[model samples]
Target: MHIGVPRESDPGQRLVAATPQTVEKLVALGYDVVVETGAGADASIPDDGYVAAGATIGDTDAVWGCDVVVKVDAPTVSEVARMHADATIVARMSPDDDPALVEAMRAAGVIALNLNSVPRISRAQALDVLSTMSNVSGYRGIIEAAEAYAGMFGGQVTAAGSTPPARVFVIGAGVAGLAALGAAGSLGATVRAYDVRSDVAEQIESMGATYVRVDAAAQESADGYASELSDEQEAATQRVYAAESAAADVVVTTALIRGKAPITITAEMVAAMRPGSVIVDLAASGGGNCELTVPGEKIVTENGVTIIGYTDLPGRMPKHTSQLYGTNIVNLMKLLTPGKDGQVVLDLDDVVQRGITVTRAGELLWPPPPVQVSVAPPAPASAPAPAEPAPAVEQKARKGTGVLVAGALTALLVVAAVAFSTASFASHLTVFALAVVVGFYVVTGVTHSLHTPLMAQTNAISGIILVGSLLQIGSTDTVVTVLAVVAATFASINIFGGFSVASRMLAMFRKEA
Candidate 1:
């Protein structure tokens, strides 16, 4: 098999399909590697590096003629038209719900393996192109903000006085938002983040960023992605959003609702922002989070604020991004490839194959799962079958059994108390024995009378009293008295603690009933 890495044709896509390292891996796997001239240049891999990795460096025409054409973006129609009928084109084709691109891949007779369509399974982590790019896109979002904001992130001490640190407000506590927060916070900026998932607030706080939350109807999908908010909820969040956005020197918005364009950032909200503030819209790829954002362009607000809508943040850091994404691509391909003995094989029965294989055997083989329909519940059963009541005689017997056990435990405790009172450490031991007996009685009483708390308080009071008695006992026997006091305190605490535990158990029984 032959694999080709082509130069990206997408306007802002700076990523290369395969780096030299990945080319080497493909070569080891029994595939001839061809890379278009300057294919990995944007990603910091020179043409010489491909040659050193045993890959042939060729022009675009030669590269496109291979058995497989790998790319960072979907190939243009013209490019597809040029491809060999049976060739496979591997790339990221998101919102694959689009029929035109789906039909084109079929007509071209080139198998399209969309990297973005991979699932978030544990075994697929290395093959998750979406997660790979997202990790980089997340990091770059903050670096872009730092560049756009004129002021330094960290505080400075000048001849005049000290200046406070810059403030960063990040919306959406997803991978991108958290990365932005981390970058800003590392530079000593006061970072605050908000998300529709209130459950993630603890994570945000753990990362040293303050979590900002507003009261609104929260909706989360089964996959844990934020669901689109209703109009009322959106309106309710605006004022709080505006206040936080207005105060921050930098704001990074990463909220995205899967297939939809990001929720619009209203003009009123933009107006509230201070002049010179910087906003990096990670959601710009899908419309934008800001009202005035132009995808892949930076727009200056009427108030002189900079709203950056650059969509391909991960592309800007292609070296590491390609390394991460290529590993994902290789892992995915390996899963699809067949092998024998010490070799790899594709299991068609695997959920991964069914989920990501968009088309097979010249047909659209992939479709989203059917939506679950709610069925009207059956009416309550008329005259529900009567449950057999527990026998009254058995209930009485169990009560008697409990009482018998309590009495045996009490008798054992009494014997121990007698032994304790006559022991050499009598004075201190007597108090502890009395306290233990009282504690057991209170716990076994079947009800939490005033004696429960009273027993606990008395246990503590006995400890203090023991110490006072020891002090009066003086030096000749002071050490002995102190030892007795320590023993008494330990025994009393254990006794009272057991009673408290019993009270808790009884509460559970009541609640269950």
Candidate 2:
């Protein structure tokens, strides 16, 4: 099958559907790739780059005429009408309940895959355009905030005085929210984040931000996305929001619901901030999380607070964002072209592919079969009851038995030293006895669940012992020499065995596993 990459006609778009790096991947999969001349120019990619990557640079007609047409935005109806029947067009088509585009796809008999529709399941994460773009937007939000703010993000300690770090409050702990909070924290800013889902609190804290606790967000997210809060709950949350926003030096909002972002920062909250403070609204395209945000514009409040409402945060950093988005396309291509034989196969049985497919077989297939986004956690096993404590008399008897065994061993060692041992031999036996007792206590203290970690620690100890014993191998005393040899042999075995077990334990943590 032939794949085509056309130049984006939209003036505001700086991203390309495919880049030089991704074109190479498509060609490696046995597909002839065609790119429109200067398609990647906005992203700082030259036409020669695509050509060097095994893509043919061609005119608009030549590129769009391929069997599969890939794009960043949804192609217009006129553009879709230009494609030949049975050809496939793939893009991040946020149809937004548009019937015209679906009707056009049906009439043209073209296969349309909307990257925005990619499932939220773990297996489909690579193909998810929303989260991928949102991550870039989140990081870019912090940069824009820093640029507009008067003071530094990080606190400074100079000979003159000490400066406190700027406090950042982020609303919504999703991909964008986490990224914003992390970026802010990395810049030495104090960060705080809040989410309607309580489960994300740990994630927020892991990013070096405090999770603002709210009692009203007692909701479970079964679809990998936060569920809508009730009106009463939202009001309860707004009450807490006022306090958080008031204390923040820079505020970022990323909450979205049904394509509309509800207001979390009111005008009163903006008025409470200091004169030089800034607010970056990442959800501006979705009506904004700030009630004062003007979409696609930056404005300063009368009180000297800056409110930024940028719809193109991802476009601000085009080079890397293009690469990431292009790679997502390549991954989707890899899934569709399983055989690497230049054939496109639409396997509806696969959830990832089916979820992105909007129109196929001369019919509109928007809203594919519903998939369960969240995996149901397995039921935990019932724990066994605790063992009852032994009687006081029984415990005392066991302790007495241990003391007797110790006394007998000490007597035997003393008799051996007095009857047949030299001073040198006695010193060696004393060291050996101490080693045995310490090793026994250390090994016995470890629980079964911690055996692997214990092995890791013991491995280092064995290495030291092996080196020390090797140094003592030339001792004149035969007993000392033999004991040294035995220690070295056992320590060698432990070193190798411990490494093997440790490697297996690390393999269990690999991302693929």
Candidate 3:
């Protein structure tokens, strides 16, 4: 029933596991929360704020000793030693799978829930710390690149000279890569992006960056991740990566698959880059996508190129990142505490819970059964494509249908008019019947795309009907009066509804004041 927030022991880590916002959520879930003093200080959340959210401030041991302890990084050796037997710990556990740490948790009787191991399935996205961290890292990575670059990002047409925009090439069109593309594009940079999954080309272009297409037929991934490429495919993709990175003013590499990161930019590629060009490797924490990237350090190559491999990009913006991470944990907590009784009840059979359970009750339960993220891509088409019908033929068919229907109806009405109407009334009936036929075909023949404008402009006809109905609203015959009133009521809607839609559509073209 007691959940705890522990201060991040890593000096470089500026994020907190639970902010006051998340603490309030925990309290609402029927759990008493204890916050280690100054745990959220790095993220600008004060102890008083935690108290206001129904959490009590306590020492490190007091907080860690609670039934459920939350953290940003994997527990350190000394940190894990302080945990009481059967206590649960949650964090974005490292992928290295260190044996010593595993043994320590097992000996301490700790239940370890690795947030990084949360499945990529749709239901588990809310608790996925990897994506939450990557979302912030992607945006911050661009800012980090701008800081290292020598020139401005956007173009300037000054009286002195016209400066061209900086060119930014992003490798990997994952969450981080797409975010980098958006930030770079917003800064007026000429952005271009590449991804091994050809299906993400539309997503890449939607971020306002050109998607570098490769002459290959790669289907969408089976698990929402980049699958391992064959040797020949890798070589072809690498050629494009090298050429783009070398030519760009700023290159960002965000390729990370499983625990290892492939070398996307090699030494020869780095050497080919122009002087003062900057490269930001977002996958630095997971080894690195760039050969020159030194994890946790920024190094300048001999050719005057800056290679930034900062592993704490998300931590750099502590406030927002902490909130994002805390919300992710709160989502996981909500799932675990479904009864709202302050008790942690995990459904081990569930893919999400089973996947996150690294060590439970002194037993290692990690490397759970693989979860299939998506069904296999459909088999290719066996038949060849046929040419489309000619536009003239298509147009002729549409015109024929409406006219034929209207003419048939008109002929039937003319026969009825002749049989039912007197001599004087027959001529009036024929004229009205002709008008109805012309109106029917005219309205029906318009293209579907023009319906909006047709409705807006057709208000004049509706107004005529409304006026005609109004003339009969005072009819002496009771049945005639009721029918006329109903017709007027329906006609008024067409007139007013048309005006309302037209006004709303016009407003879209006007500038905001």
Candidate 4:
């Protein structure tokens, strides 16, 4: 089997798909490895390095003509035309946004394995290119924003005066947002983050940044990505952005709705910001989070706000990016490589293969099936039917027993109510505390799998509790009113907190595009 490592032809794509270390591994796996001349030059890996690792340095045609070809970006129409028929190409093919690339690969009869389509399962984490790149992009965005701003990130006290720390506001709490938050906070900037899914508050706070709360329901899809906001929710978010941006020295927007453009930072919000404020839009590649952001250009508004829209932040650190990307490629290759023979095997039955296999065997399988199909075995023979129920007399007897039990319960409740009316406040409080303890235990008994639904249900129950507390707010007793207000406040927290937890868990299931 022949595996080719082609030079990345995309503009500003310095990261290569494989490093010499990865090339050596592939060579040892019984494959003839060939790397294009100067393929890894930008990433600091010379042709001599590839040669040292037992890989032959070849020309563009030689590299693309191999049985397996890998590169950093999607193949261009011209590049696809050079690939051998039925050759498998592994790269970050943005199928959703680049339908033409999918068609091009199909027409060229190449099996395109898109790294971006790798599932978010535990086994696939080592092969997640999107995550590896996003981590770099997130951290780099902070650096870009800080550099573009005229002010300093950390506060300093000099003989002249004290310079205040920069205030950073991050929109979206996904992988990139969290990275930006960590980086900004480490630089001594006062950071705050906002997300449509409220569940990321703890994560945000964990990074030493405050979490901004918005008056909106969580908008997380089942796959764990943030869904499009409703009209009212968008309005609320815009208001929050306007206020936050006005007070922010730097704002990093990483909010991305898969397959759609992200516009979390509007031009109006930018105009509201003070002079010298910086806005870094990490979603610039997919349109951008800021309305005024050009895909690959930086611009300063008349108000003196700088919007940095550089798309390939990961490429800025090509060495590390290529190292991480190379490991991801090697990990994915392990799944496709069946044995020491190094032949590429297409196992559609495997979840990872099914996910990344966009085109297979000259057929365009773009947007692979959501779920794999499985055949169920035939059932065994069934048992005989049971006998019929008892006669009407038995039914009447059962109804009589139920009425007796109900009447007995009603009598007991009446006696208990009379006793409770005369009981002291401490005794009533004891009963309430005991009920809370019982409820806590009941909740703890539920399995982890049901925790999200349980939390949601408890949130609704807490809202009801808030309503009851509200009714008591106008009570004649001062003590009763004060306690009611406290109860209502705590209930409100529980309701919001419950939604936050559920939203966070849902977000975990979102696969990278």
Candidate that scores best on TM-score: 2
TM-score of 4: 0.71
TM agreement with the true structure for every prediction: 0.70, 0.76, 0.74, 0.71
Model 4: runs farther than 4 Å from truth?
A: 96-100, 371-513
Instruction: Show model 3 residue runs off by greater than 4 Å.
Output: 217-221, 377-513
Clashing pairs in 4: none
Worst 10 residues of 3 by lDDT: 442-451
Ranking by lDDT: 2, 3, 4, 1
RMSD in order of candidates: 13.5, 8.9, 9.8, 13.3
Error of 2 at 157 (Å): 1.5
- Winning model by lDDT: 2
Give the runs in model 1 whose Cα sits over 4 Å from its true position.
95-98, 158-160, 338-347, 368-513
Evaluation by TM-score, superior candidate among 1 and 3: 3
The TM-score that candidate 3 achieves is 0.74
Give lDDT tens digits, candidate 1, residues 44-152.
8899999999899888888888878888887777787777876777888753556777777777776667776665556666777766766687789888888888888
Candidate 4, position 390, lDDT: 82
lDDT of all predictions, in order shown?
0.75, 0.86, 0.85, 0.84
Tell me the tens digit of each residue's lDDT in model 2 across 77-175. 988878999999999786656779888988899999999888788878888889988999999999999999898899999999998999999999888
lDDT of 3 by residue, 261-380 (tens): 999899999999999999999999889989989999999999999999999999899998998899998999999998988999978988899988878888888667787787565457
Instruction: Give one clash count per candidate, in the order shown.
Output: 1, 1, 0, 0
Lowest summed-lDDT stretch of 10 residues in model 2? Answer: 442-451
